[model samples]
Target: MVKLSNTEIRKLDDAARAGWLYYVAGKTQDEIAKKLNISRQSAQRMVALSVSQGLIKVRLDHPIAKCMDLAQKTKKSFWFSIV
Candidate 1:
């Protein structure tokens, strides 16, 4: 599991909803903002955060395995010790 900052954790639900509203329900950022009672910029940022944080996948056409490669590199860089 990935660790989340307090703010990121708090936004997870909204981010998921925002992405769904934009992608599945076909809502514009302005519409989403109205529905979610947030600023349009917040709506847009939530949609992007959902994708960047992997809260949801807007499409399945892209390969997620490439992300796994980056994860491995990060683990090697930060968590592994030289022997």
Candidate 2:
């Protein structure tokens, strides 16, 4: 891992806060920018940086079993290929 200088650490912290506000708090980028006292473009960049630095994590939960069963039934009943 690369060492971060104090300024870099502060920037990362700001980015993480911006990301949390946008993702978890459901704030708009404009709102985040206003709240953080930064420009909209800066807020956008901070959010992206937070994601790139692994400060943000995203998980998608899918019902694969249910979907597969429904697809199989549909294919059997309709004789249609589901690819």
Candidate 3:
């Protein structure tokens, strides 16, 4: 892999921001590319990197607990339980 310079790192950061603002935030890729003054492919690649780096996190709010009391209370609060 090519070592990135400070400038290039800054560029990468800009790319990351553009990617998150566009792809993850539901803005169009074209708009992101245009805003970043880069090609659409570059924008897409940045988004891919964001995911690969674990910067893009996807989660379900279900909690796992060994405590019976907490589990029972949670189950009572929520209609659907996933314990």
In order, the Cα lDDT scores of the candidates are 0.87, 0.95, 0.73
- Local accuracy of candidate 3 as per-residue lDDT tens digits, 1-83: 98989997886687679658765778777777888888988888877776676667655455443465577778889866855
Name the better of 2 and 3 by TM-score: 2
Q: In model 3, which runs have C-alpha deviations exceeding 4 angstroms?
A: 1-8, 62-83
Q: What lDDT tens digits, residue by residue, belong to model 1 across residues 1-83?
A: 98989987778989999999998889999999999999999999999998998877644455886786678788788997433
Query: Which candidate achieves the best TM-score against the true structure?
Result: 2
Model 1 spans with C-alpha error above 4 angstroms: 2-7, 60-83
Model 3 scores a TM of 0.55
Q: Candidate 2, residue 56: CA error in Å?
A: 0.3
Candidate with the greatest lDDT versus the true structure: 2
Write the residue-wise lDDT of candidate 2 on 1-83 in tens digits: 99999999999999999999999999999999999999999999999999999999976567886788899999999999998
lDDT of 2: 0.95
